[model samples]
Target: MPAEWEPHEGTWLSWPRREGISFPGRYDAVPALWRAMVTTLATGEHVYVNVGDEAQEAEVRAVLFGHEAVARTALDASAATSLATTVRGDRVSLHDRVSLHRIPTDEPWCRDHGPTFLVRDGELTLIDWRYNAWGGKYPPYDRDDAVPSRIAELLGVRAFHPGIVLEGGAIDVNGRGTVLTTESCLLNPNRNPSLGRAEIEAYLREYLNAPHVVWLGAGIAGDDTDGHVDDLTRFVAPRTVVTAVEADPADVNYGPLRENLHRLRAAHDQDGRSLEVVELPMPGAVEWEGQRLPASYANFYVGNEAVLVPTFAHDNDAVALDVLRRCFPGRRAVGIDATALVWGLGAFHCATQQQPLAVHT
Candidate 1:
């Protein structure tokens, strides 16, 4: 698996459906966030969106291509900047950069169900990890599970079936040989009861080309996927990671996050070098109707020219952005208001999957 900061041919997004179970009530308000992502991502690389049908494709087009009108009405101030000025105040052409595929999905969490791309020996391949809808927390994921094969067919790339339950969001790689994941998510019997830790690690080694695996303890509170590492920690460099930390000792996330940080510091990369850990502040707590949503700055998606970060309306929004900017010094770190997006239980990283650029020999 290529690192997210690596060049990308495009980013994959499984367009959300109005009737989908992700956003129960805030479906209407979700398109604005999609527009923000499409426009900002289009500025750096092509965006391949998976739509169920023509109508869904057309709706996505309106929100992305009609930036002039939508920017004035639908987009707020921050999103307006994404649509109008991205690099050097230049307007991005979403019409040229965004392409809609007819591939359908059961839900919008592409990071979990979308294709995981691998570039090795100048060849790009796709991995079709069995998706049981996060341990069957959500059912009828047939469409989502088929996304990798469909995308492989579309891209004319070879698809490899790992024959195990693994979400793309369950692991993070440094484009080297090191992988980051949580034992809570990967070891849960709900996911792959038949496979043990060593067996799962072997799968990661064979498929992702990651020989070293760093296992974290657990995820934050209200994380429905047991404990996905993407919300808890992320690889910023080959030997460096930025983990989410909760300062309040009384908070439910404090202990778990602190433990993960300690593990990262003692962890080693593929070269047996000690890892450098950076602390990324959590956006306090974002709740909707007494339900705490999984909102973490670690969910930022790295683009070719920008990093789309999930920012709750908190004072730490600036702090997170600054931290990400420093981590990805060459890219613009743009924080989109995820107050409404996280109500669906995920943010940008959860909604996107990066397709790394392949260079043929």
Candidate 2:
């Protein structure tokens, strides 16, 4: 398997359509978030967006055109700026390193459905894990399930089918030998009820080439997909993890999050070293129609030169940005107002996938 820390050739994103789960009457906001994220990523690396047709691609071009920001202004601006000029025609050019693809996909959460590329012994390979629309939360997911294979075909690479249901959001790799995940998401009866925790861990080790599997108990309240680890914790570096925490014991996530913290503290890495844990505050509960949304700051996506964090326009946005800035010293931490975006129950990381540069022998 390729090292998870390898530099990405570009990131993949699927344009949000009007008709999809979590996207009823909120298509504009969702695409706007996608535009912002793609623009921000263009500043640092390449971005490949999957558009359904020419019409959608034209609309996307117009949106990106309106967001172009000069390099100097971007540095001084505290608020997010769009790099509109970089996107033209069907291609959004960013310093010759960035490229955009108009591939067709049914849903927008490509990170969960896209191919997990790995490099082994100077050879590039792909891990095509089965994606069942978050444990069949949505059906007829034939399109989403085929995305990884399509990407692998485009890259002319070999893809290995793990045959088990898994989403990229459920696992975090340390680029060495450790992978972190939550039992609530992986072992949930909805996903793979037949497989035990140990069995699932065995699968991860065999496919991801992981030597150690650290399990967290559950996810926070209001997460629809049982407990995706991306929304609760992330590996900032090998042996270092940033996890969400609720200071108030009365908060709904207090117990579950604290339990995960305890496990992480007791867990050891491949080297048997205790994990370095950083606590990030969860965005205040955001409820829509009596339903709480999964609003978490730990769902931030790491780009080539920046980290795109989902901000809820809450009082904690600045604090979350600062925490991420500390975790990624040299990389800029830009916040995308995800208040409107989360209505669909996903954020930046959930919507984007990274393609590592092809390794050479």
Candidate 3:
């Protein structure tokens, strides 16, 4: 599978429905954030969205048109610098670098339910791991489970189904043969009680073609997906990774994050080289209605020319961006305000999937 940091042709997103189960009371604000994200992503690479039908596509186009106008208005010389961080540094025209596909979806967490793209010898393929709504926390995920097949049909590529439940958010990989994941999510009985760690690793090796699997411990507090590595750790390079570390000993995430750090420190890449691990700061707890949400700087999405980071309104937002900037020297790490977006328990990385740019002869 192509690493998240690799150049992409486009990013795939499932537009949220007004009646979807993802955002209960925050639905009204969700689409606006999506538009902002789309605007930023469209300038660098194509933004593929799944709209259910003609009306939904029209609604999405209207939103895109309005945002495009905002982007166009910012074409002034002084506005260029500011919009570079907010959306894009260039103008956004209607139907520009975006393709609307009519596909039904139940939720907007595309990373959890989207097709995991793979490439080999200038050809692209997809792997459709089973999706059970993060081990059945939410029911009636039929539409989500079928998304990979629908995407494969649209792309005209062969898709393989491993028949074991896994979410794209659960694993992060280097373009090489190293894959990072957590035991808490994959080994959860609700998803695949029948398989053991070795068995699951074997599947990951075979499907992702990444023989090196680095297993971390649990996830942060309030993460519905038991322990998604994206919320705890992610690969920043072929032999390097940045993991979330909580300083406060009394915090719930401290012990688990430290344990994962220890594991990463001792981990090695496919070539048997020790990994260079970087520690990223964790933001202060973000809660909504008395419930702590899964807010982490590690949940950053790498696009073609930019890395979209989920930044909470915290001091660490700047720190995370700076650290990621150093890790990804070639790509700019753009932070998005995820304070309101995380009300759905995910951030920018969770809402999108990348399609690698196909190599041409």
Candidate 4:
């Protein structure tokens, strides 16, 4: 798989359905948050939005129009100055940078459900790993599970199906032949019971074109996906990984996080080179409706020239941005408030997937 930090022709997102498990009570407020991400991303690249049908697409156009109006009204003189060439009063016009698709999905977690685009030998192919709705936690997820192959059909891209189950969020890769994943998610019998450690590792390497696989212990708390690596550790550089560290020992996450950190420190790359591990401080516990939602700085999304970090109205938001900025010196690290988004058990990265720029011969 191509490194997420690499330039993208666009990003793909599945619009949240009212019937989906995410944002159960607050569907109205969720669209604006998505619009915020859409607007930011549309400023630079194409945004392919998945809708249920033409009717839903019509609804989406209206929503985008409302968002654009509100955004223009809220912009200050400086911000307004930056947006000089504004869209005229065309109904259902937000930014003309979207390619709407009628791809039906049960939920809006695109990173896990969508295709993992990989580039090899100057060709782009969609790696469609079997998605079992995070170990069948959410039933009737047949639509989401079928999304990868559907996307390949939509874009006319060749797709390679490995047959074994895998979710995009469960693995992190450095464009340079190395991958990081968690045993908690991959080894779970709910996902692939027949596959052992060596077997699963082989599939990952072959499918991702990755030569090395670094296995971590577990993921953070309350992540319903069993244990997605995106919520724990991420690859910032080829030999560098930025992982979350829990400071409070009394917290349940402390032990698992510390163990993962220790594992990462002792871990080496494919060439047996010592891996450089950077410890990122975790945010304080964020609970809502008597449940601890998975909130971590590690779930940030890497966009073209911008790293959108998930900020939880915490002081460490700045700290996380600083660390990521150093790691991605060429990209602008901006934080988006994910307090409400994580109630859905995901943030920016989970909601988006990159459509890599294809090399033209």
Candidate 5:
């Protein structure tokens, strides 16, 4: 098995275009948020984005460049920048720091569709986990499913096929020998009903190269993709996890989430050391069109210098940010307004995938 990938040199994101998948009347916000995210990321590292064609590329450039804040203004106001920029024909540079690609793809969730890059013995490999559009919840995912292989080919890396129904958001690694996941997502009948827990563990061991798997029970309420572990628990450090907690027993997630918390506290890591579990308060439930979206604080994506956390403009947003700040020392933990983004049922982590740098032995 290959070694786990390290932090990515940059992130890959798909520009949102499908109205049905993104939610009605909110398609405009998708591009805005995508641009904003890319701009913020470009300040630290490169950003590779996929667009449909010349037309779409033009749209992306207009959204990004048109809003490129003057360096001085950006440093002071931070709010003058628009997420999208003006199209410099087919290619546009965001302050000479970011690069955009116009690759055509059907879905925008690159974290699930993009290649899972890993390194072993100083060699780069790609783990192409089968994606089924979140258990076939969205149909016609042919383009999305093919993204991993395309990325692998583009990168000229060896692509390994893990013939199992796995989404990147379903698992979290500690960069050690331990992984954290929830049974509700990985064990669901839709994903791999024939595979027992032991069999699944074997698959994880073979692909992720992890010796230990810590199982948390379920995710918080409003998670459509069963219980994606990324929306509930994350391994902030080796042998340490930060889980979302709900204190009010009246809330729907209070019981199941608490049970998961208990399980995490009782678990141990690969070294047989008890896990240090931290609690992050769940943001007040967010409902749109009477449907609760999976607005979670656990879905923050870890970057080189910062952890991009999704905040729902709720009271708990500050507390969650603070908790993550404590958890990630030396890394800025900043919250991105996710009130509009969650309408698509995912956040920063789901929207981006890390292509870990090849490790030299």
Candidate 6:
């Protein structure tokens, strides 16, 4: 698997269904967020979206083309600026860069259900890991589980089934042989009870082409995915990881994040070099309807020319953007307000999956 920052032929997203469980009562507010995400990403690389049916595809077309009026409830003023260049007349015409496929999914969290693109012998291969909807927390995930194979068939590529349950969001790779994940999600009896740590590691090494595995402890507070590492840490470089840290000792996330920080500082890359750990501040606690949602700056998505960092309108939004800008100096770091999107317990990274640029050998 290639690092997210690597050149990508495109990005994939499963459009949120109005009846999907992710956004619940806020489903009306999610499409605008997806539009903003797609528009920003299409400016850099091709964006492929999956819709459940022809009707859903038509709905997505309207949303992207301005045939329908999007309620800008989720995006803040900055998103307006980000959407400016991509717009034409009343429509955001990314006709050349955006394509919608009739790949149905039960939910819109594609990173957890979408294809994990891998390059093998200079060709693109996808891994179809068994998905149990965060360990059976969500039922009727049969459709989401079949997404990888669906996409493989569509693209005419070889698909590999690890046969074990693993969400794309659970792991992050450095593209140079190192993978980062958390023990909480992978080791929890919920995900893979039949496999031990060693067995899981073996699968990751064999499938992801990552020989080094750096394991973190727990996830942040209120993350429904049993602490997905994408919400805790991400690899911004071959040997450098930008992790989220909570400054308030009283906050529930402080201890676990601190422990993860310690582990990253001690972790080494496949080349046996100590990792360069950069600390990114947490966006405090994001709540909706009296329930806390997992919101972290670490959930930013790296595109060909832009880093879409999720912001919660918090003061630290600028700080997180600055930290990431420094980390990815060559890429533009744009903060898209995720206050409404985080209600679904995810941000940019959870909804988007990268399709690495094929290197024909």
Best by lDDT: 6
Clashes of 3: 0
Compose the digit string of candidate 3's lDDT tens values, residues 1-361. Answer: 8888787888999998888877888887777678767766776788999988888888887777645334322122333354445443345442667889998888988998999999867888889989999989998999999999999999898899899999999999998998999889988999999999999999999999999889888999999999898888888888889999999999888999999999988989999999999999999789988999989999988887777788777898889999999998987676777776798899888999999877841
**Candidate 6 or 5, higher TM-score:** 6
lDDT of 5 by residue, 1-361 (tens): 2222246667788888754466568886667677657766665567788787788888877877765443322111332232223223223445465656656677787877777767766677878888888788888888888888887777788889979988888888876778888888899888887998999999888887888999988777778778888889888877678898988899889998899988988999988999998998988778998988888898888877667888887789889988998988877676778777788888998888876666641
Native-vs-model 6 lDDT?
A: 0.89
The regions of model 2 sitting more than 4 angstroms off are: 1-6, 66-92, 95-98
Clashes of 6: 0
What digit string (tens of lDDT, one per residue) describes model 1 on residues 289-308? 89888989999999998898
lDDT for each residue of candidate 6 in 34-64, tens digit (9 for 90 to 100): 9888887887899999998988988898888
Query: Candidate 3, TM-score vs. the true structure?
Result: 0.93
Q: What local lDDT does model 3 show for residue 137?
A: 90
Q: Give candidate 4 misplaced runs (Cα > 4 Å).
A: 67-94
lDDT scores of the candidates, listed in order: 0.88, 0.79, 0.84, 0.83, 0.76, 0.89
Segments in model 3 whose C-alpha atoms lie over 4 Å from true places: 67-94
- Would you estimate the TM-scores of all the predictions? 0.96, 0.91, 0.93, 0.93, 0.90, 0.96
Clashes (backbone N, CA, C under 3 Å), per candidate, total: 0, 8, 0, 0, 13, 0
Which pairs of residues collide in candidate 6? none
The candidate, 1 or 5, that scores higher on lDDT is 1
CA displacement after TM-score superposition, residue 15 of candidate 4 (Å): 0.5
Please tell me which model should have the higher TM-score, number 2 or number 5.
2
lDDT of 1 at 331: 91
lDDT of 3 at 181: 91
Put the candidates in TM-score order, highest first: 6, 1, 3, 4, 2, 5
Candidate 6 residue 209 Cα shift, in angstroms, is 1.3
